[model samples]
Target: MATDRLGLYVHIPYCVRKCNYCDFCSLPNGGAQVPEAYVDRIIDEILSYSGRVSTPVDTVYFGGGTPSLLSSTQMARIVYTIRKSLNISPHSEWTLEVNPGTLTKEKVDAFFNLGFNRVSLGLQSIHENEMKTLGRIHTFDEFISSYNMLRDAGFGNISVDLMYGIPHQTLASFKKTLDTVISLSPEHISVYGLIVEEGTPFYQWRESLPLPTLDEECDMYELAGRQLAVAGYEHYEISNYARDSYRSRHNSLYWRFGEYIGVGAAAHSFFAGQRYFNTDNVDDYIASSGISVTQTPESECDLEYEYAMLGLRLKEGISLSDYESLFGHSFIDGKEQIISRLEEAGLLTLDGDRLALTEHGFYLSNSILVEIL
Candidate 1:
């Protein structure tokens, strides 16, 4: 079943407004309306891979630009097209990424009515000044209102996104944001550290921004682990925390090196041992029917390294048996010395058949992964 299952990701490339720190492929809304024909193009792309998908899709994620920007009717049309064109499992985990101020009661109801089971809300920060600096259109109040609206619309699985290391974000302020989010008891929480990516407004002003000190940023990450643990949320991945069994299954597919199809402008796909992404240009994507992107074939070595890198991001890490069975090579080969060294430093844990990172190791994951890879 694991080998035959499929995951679907649909990218909605339009946003109500773009954030200052974002470098993701997205366009801000002007006076122009969202292209209704874009859904048709996405459907066309899905059917292009018709021969490869032998089993029903297990998950569907409507990632954004702001999927919430679509009207209920528009979203429903796309959802309907996906099911009509593909073999979707009856128990599929369908999720949409929504921004706070963009959600409407009608859209929320449409999502629930259409069988979308999860909503990942973008509530970057609750602090007013921080929100403005980040160029987010929604306020803390708006986030709360949108959240309540989702609940009323019958979304039991919701994830709240929070940011740390924000400009002028003090420890006290970050703690308060976390506390507020925890009080609401959303099914999942995604805590991320701020980064000034190139081509963004924050990058140009990075030198002058009053961002937290390196020490302070580290402190915030550590604090998040401690606080979330006390609140009964599992630190399942480096940037993700979930309560009970609410871990993101679609995302888990990615970490497990499972195959998936991504459709839309700037979307990426990994299937049948190849990886490719659609063109970043919206016009090109639409005109070309989403086939203008380059596809790269992966070598056996590249896949092995990818599995190690991605698997190490999880709390359970890599299963030695799975690695050997899949690749016909032991993951411990030649890397035992480095792994043993990391274990001695308390950055990694060798628990019988799995090689996982300790909590401290997760914080230094980038460096550790580089060393191993």
Candidate 2:
């Protein structure tokens, strides 16, 4: 939980099939690639950090198109490399993002043996029609099977991801999805609003798709917060909810502006007051050993803006004292009128030194942030 510690993010940019709405840097038909070569490249990238990054890594997150697609042996290779090359803490929270139908009992056991204590399952919906419309390869039954496999293997920390505002998705269907997932009682739940990114199939078909209107999406978001709270899950972030002590530690680092190092194709890093990212082209990453292309340094003013912006995503919001100490100026210096107006509208809460969004504010966080920042 300490901000001084580092987090490692390993990106696996391959998937069985690209979802219609996905625009992330990933290659479909990943099974056709030589797994061993990609795994070796990732290991090499990890070793490249040896002796350079000395901060103890307390969290490791395997995120991607589908990290569970890798063979257990392949995953083990990367895990071992990280342990050997980095100051990896023994109690680190290692999480793997898995898709249903890509896991088995043996694989689950292997992941546990490799020191993974958390598993994030991607289950967008429970309805057959919705899953089909989303281009998800797994059935609701497959997700249940995968969840059970993790539980049976003694993995207590599990997070299930759900989405609202999908094509042809309705409030009733989303509520059913929430009910079914809550019944499972996973340690954490993430409800995301769908974004139709440019260049994605959804963008091309935007007019024809039966996507939820802005009002409908807002309704679904409210429904999630209400139901998840009743189910004993804390809405810790804008989209993330968790039971006691189950908030995602790895992701928390990001919101807190803590330093982290990312490895693999299209991965990003925020460390030593600089932000940089690797090339999105997987083939180029393999050839270049996942070299990072650093960007221009952000101005001190830029840093201050970012720190407050990212911190406000948390329910805890920003500590005014800390912000002033870090930037040597009051966060409210120029934004008093804006903050006062937001508070009067019940969109923001200013409790002494802490400033955070109200539930309503979180729903319109983008516009609110634009005004404040």
Top candidate (lDDT): 2
* Tens-digit lDDT track of model 1 for 1-373: 1467889999989887888999998999851457877767877787676665777799999997888888877877788778877889989999999888887687788789999999999987889999999999889999999999999989999999999999999999999999999999999999998989999999999999999998998899989999999999999999999999999999999999998889999999886667898988888888885355688776888889999899999999999999999999788889889999999999999999999999999988999999988
Model 2 stretches with alpha carbons more than 4 Å out: 1-3, 30-34
Stretch of 10 with least lDDT, candidate 2: 29-38
Candidate-wise lDDT, in order: 0.89, 0.90
Candidate 1 Cα misplacement greater than 4 A, ranges: 50-52, 290-292
Tell me the TM-score of each prediction against the true structure. 0.96, 0.97
RMSD of each: 1.6, 1.6
Candidate 2 clashing pairs, residues 3+ apart or interchain: none
Model 2, C-alpha of 67: deviation from truth (Å): 0.7
Model 2, span 55-129: residue lDDT tens? 899999999988998888899899999999999887899999999988888989999999999999999899988
Q: Pick the candidate with the highest TM-score.
A: 2
Candidate 1 C-alpha RMSD relative to the actual structure? 1.6
